[model samples]
Target: MSKDVWVIIEHQDGAPKKISLELLGRARELAETLGGTVVAFVPGAGVSNVAESLGSRGADIVYAADHALLQPYTADAYAQAVSQALQAEQPTLVLVGSTAQGRDYAPRVAARLGAGIVTDCASLEVADGHLVATRPMYTRKTIGTVVFSSGGIRIAVVLPAVYSVPPAEAGRRAEIRAFQVALDSKGVRTQVREVRAIQRETVPLTEADVIVSGGRGLKGPENFALLDALAKALGAAVGSSRPPVDSGWVSHDYEIGQTGKTVSPQVYLACGISGAPQHLAGMSGAKYIVAINKDSNAPIFQLADLGIVGDLFEIVPKLTEAIRQAKGRA
Candidate 1:
């Protein structure tokens, strides 16, 4: 395999996703170490501008794969296109974000190329000319290190928020190349007809820097307003434990636990969550955790950086007001 590192870019709203930029940043570092070029592979319909935008963001070469069928993101089309490119180029290492789309297509690409892949990697480094990756195992109770056998392409699916995004350098441009993939449009089975969105003011839970989450103690669906206020004041996202989701108090999109979305935010505020093991499996990677619960002995308190023993009904409004006042004065 060539020493080049290829980053399969994921985009939304015609711009690269945050996780894709993070992968590019890490790929830049790896490429520098390997004395190789950082190559960004962007596949979508009318994504030429997106490829150009990545030029200043540490990519030495940008491959623009524009096609009509690539839009709306069908895993079948993506896996087929990327696997073919990988088989032709055979880059030394490939980096993909562990986002929903990445998790789905990356494995298919690896399978098609007969390459070794490690998913949900929290840490990555090159040692002795080999890529070493670390991932949380067994609900994050332990960390597992994976080493690949020599003589083939290696792929790693990275978790979000684990690495910092590098600042873009203005006026820097990379060599842009046009990539083409052959596909039978009629054979594409999966087609996205429409997208229905959940109307919420808060940022998406996985991408939020701060998260304010609740649990069974929220009592009812109406109580989520408390979390909404706090999340709004802190410019955070609102999330929930499985208990609240199971009770139909909130959508499953808001659930943060083993059976739900895994998040590693800068700060996570747990309101009335008891910190079940399954729940902790998803958010144990947060930089700081604050738990508010009436039960002093709640399991969440043990993992919390700061624990408040009090009724959330009384504490939430006050906390929201305090944050608003602080922001107002600033």
Candidate 2:
């Protein structure tokens, strides 16, 4: 019987991605409840150190595939490697982060293995020795629980920042298995020509404890400078709604909505944003929400813990100044 739980580890520049560790934590819990072992799969160039770290984060085994062909993310290569590994180990459930890379590769891997694939899962549970996944539907107004009956294995692509990372334990031992790579040069349709990583001053939106988001109500793209100033003063990350992203005012990576990143920060400050259901679905898990908008009837106010009715242009600057003073940085 398929019994082990496997989490695919994602990394860049030799450092593990935060969501990969979070997956390990959640997988560990599920494995414990199901009386199974938790394993991790890391595919890249020279990723043994990353595999070691996964062991410290509750993985019973680490499958490392370090090869030149696996240097950059290619859907075919990843699918081939993971599919082969799954055939060898026969894990009952496999978890992947719902990031862009996983969004592309998870379905391919599931198809190759003839398994069930559930995307953008917000919650996971083990019921009747099967993995049941829950994801939002109807623009986040409702949730649907999916139970896989594929028999071979179940796969889930989890949203980032929805789950917390487990504590790392030092000196944890894991069986490290070196997997062989099977690359089909003919099947590799796309080649990565270049990789340009964005260097920004603020923390990543998915990892930030506090987030300050804005929308079309800011009026213009240049006005985002004020939003940045407030975010810097509050030591928070800046996020945007779909309108801003669709308007090309901000990069898609900075967008927080059903179509973008899902963040559950300790505090979410929405300024000049009309809370479309899509945007709220991404940030509703925030511990506290504060909305600042000129229209008192904005949908955002309904979900906010504190709602301020005023012109954001006039209010944001004063709020930024006040926060700076409170921090003694004025």
Candidate 3:
């Protein structure tokens, strides 16, 4: 098909990023429904080797733009290359992962193409032949939906963990084509001197499907280990309420609330949490919620799909062991 959907591929240390693969998986379904082709577009140096990997995730073709200076991820280089691709290919929709690099570059590409753009989108659909995107608004307390009615190319940046990963097909092969876009001699003004990776959890918070979070009710900073152990047993990420973060019991990065990162995991196990409005704003969108608290009257129970009234100290370990045994049997 001539009309195509483009998924931007992001890679680091010669490995594809998780969020990009998620987009490709969802893009594949959309492409099939719309009777269009799925294209994976990669712009960086020495990226030709990743074409097959992209194809396995549902890309029919790989449009690779490799250049020496493009490896460092300058906004100017990526924007120019993607804009050039849109002009040459005229894709029906552009999908990008809402990551650090994407947050910077997607807007530039949108401005360059004069396309209607949406950021931090959590879901996508095609209705009435128009690309529509849904995103969290008002600090994630409300959902906002947008449709591209400009009759121009559509661009959207999807958030992490919004879609499940697609199974890989090792034998799949995609058509590879080298896309060329000459960079202006003075266009890229900034230089990336170095990139130092931060120490991250096994599963990043936003990318986690299941999360075990603690709050002020835990009583002590050291008690976080209880949730940590439970999280490890379930292969989940550990998160926190603002009180623990403010008390220095956990890092601010683990905090989930109005002032913290937004999460929409498949299952959110809130341990010793009171379900304050600020905290609810972040995780209320979870697909299923299980609240464990000593107080049966805790407000969190209102939003929880399942509620367990008891001391988390005694309950968490038992639950962890059950899950461990279940996994072992499986």
- Among all candidates shown, the one with the greatest lDDT: 1
List the candidate 1 regions with Cα displacement exceeding 4 Å.
none
lDDT tens readout by residue for model 1, 70-135: 998999889888887888888999999988899999999888888999999999999987789999
Full candidate order by TM-score, most accurate first: 1, 2, 3
Instruction: Return the candidate ranking by lDDT, descending.
Output: 1, 2, 3
Tens digits of per-residue lDDT for model 3 on 1-330?
146889989987676788888999998999987788999999899886676578778889998888887978898888888888887788888899877789899999998878879998989998888788898887666789888887667888998778888999888878999988787748887888998765755588877889999999899899998988899999999999999999999888898877786787999999999998889978887899999999989999999999999989999999999999999999
TM-scores of the models, in the order given: 0.97, 0.93, 0.88
Could you give candidate 2's per-residue lDDT for residues 1-330 as a string of tens digits?
567899999998677899998999999898888778998999988997888777788889888988777878899888888888887888888999988789999999988888888998989997886678888877678889988766878889998877898888888878998888777767778899999887778989988889999999998789999999999999999999998889989888889988888887989999999999989888887889999999999999989999999999999999999999999954
Question: With candidate 1 superimposed using the best TM-score fit, by how many Å does residue 210's alpha carbon deviate from the native?
Answer: 0.7
lDDT of 3 at 10: 91
lDDT of each: 0.91, 0.88, 0.87
- Single out the weakest 10-residue window by summed lDDT for candidate 1: 182-191
Q: Which wins on TM-score, candidate 2 or candidate 3?
A: 2
Each prediction's number of clashing residue pairs: 0, 0, 0
